[model samples]
Target: MTTTELINQIRKKKSFLCIGLDVDLNKIPQHLLKEEDPIFAFNKAIIDATHHLCVAYKPNTAFYEAYGLKGWKALEKTIKYLNEKYPEIFTIADAKRGDIGNTSTMYAQAFFEDLAFDSVTVAPYMGKDSVEPFLAFKNKHTILLALTSNAGAFDFQTKTVEGKELYKQVLDTSKTWENAENLMYVVGATKAEYLAEIRNIIPDSFLLVPGVGAQGGNLQDVCKYGMSENVGLLINSSRGIIYASSGEDFAAAAASKAEALQKEMAVELG
Candidate 1:
């Protein structure tokens, strides 16, 4: 989906919430295991229950890869279900993939063309050549990893490379790449204090923030510092929402969690 289309959905839904479908068999309701395809079954139920409460759904690729072929197939079915049923809700493949130029192109094709995700997260450690390939795709976004919320983030992202922080340099250098307009970024909600300076570098770009709820990132602080004129944020909550319950009412429980966030987001938007 294009930026305008995504923004419109945010406006229509009164939310910029991005639900993370990082399903783990151990964490999901055991009853779902009886289904022919438990992974997709779980995802479909969650989507049906909470579709109207959020504007995006992100399925981190690692979750599917862990279960091998069956997991992969479930991911395919999940994305297909979203595209066919609720095309307006933006989809993100949280793959964090980055490699040599040729490999990056193939990775891009896998997520953008084959799986048909609207966006995919990528690491910027390999620099422009590794990332520009993903950005080349029309209307498909390459969400670069910037200031992450992980404890180890300070090891590299915040370290000074020359005079500026490494993450800031990534943001500045990325703007010169081809099709930079299609770029979004991963800025962890836990690092909300750094957002003001990060925003100064790319004020108009969208940020896929993933440290809220279970990770202890405050919604109000993130919005206070990171929000752009277009409300450029996709706040993600994974274990907190999806694992709200491990019973038959899991989907309804997930919806309740999502609705609470959406209401907070509505207030933030106002």
Candidate 2:
């Protein structure tokens, strides 16, 4: 989806929430274990229940890859269901992939061409060559990692490289890349303090922010510094939403959690 389309979804839904489909078999309802494809079954139920409450769904690729081929198949089914059913909802393959130029091309094709994800997360450690290949795809977004929410982030991201922090360098240097307009970024909500400076570096780019719910990042703080005139943020909530209930009412419970967040988001958007 284009930036305008995404912003329109936010306006129409009165939400900027992106539900993370980070399904863990161990945590899912026990009854689903008997399904033909438990992972997809869980995802389908969650998506059906919560689709109207949020604007996007992101499936962290590692969650699917863990179960091997069946897991991958389950991911395919989940993504296909989303595409065929809710074409308007943005889909993100949170792969965090980056490699040599040729290898990156194949990864991009796998997610963008074959799977048809609207966006995929990429690690910017390998620099521009590792990222530009993903940007080559038309209408597909390459969300580069910036200041992450994890505790370990300060160890490297905040450290000075020459005169500036490494994360800031990544943001500034990325703008000089080809197809830079199609680039979005991953800025962890816990790192909201850095957002003002980050925004000054790229005022218009969208940011896919995780850590809002489960990681204890405050939504108000994120919006205060991170929000752009376009309302450029896709705030993700994973476990706190999907696992809201581990009982028979899991999907409904998940929907409730998502709806609550959407309400909060609506208030923020207003």
lDDT of 1 by residue, 71-167 (tens): 9999999999999999998999999999999999999999999999999999999999999999999999999999998999999999998899999
The CA lDDT at 210 in model 1 is 93
- Name the weakest run of 10 consecutive residues (lDDT summed) in model 1: 153-162
Off by over 4 Å in 1: none
lDDT per residue, candidate 2, 1-270, as tens digits? 888999899999999999999989999999999999999999999999998899999999999999999999999999999999999999999999999999999999999989999999999999999999999998999999998989999999999998999999999999999999989999999888889999999998999999997898999999999999999999999999999999999999999999999999999998
RMSD of each: 0.6, 0.7
Q: In candidate 1, which residue pairs clash? A: none
* Estimated TM-score for each candidate: 0.99, 0.99
Cα-based lDDT at residue 145, candidate 1? 97
Clashes of each: 0, 0
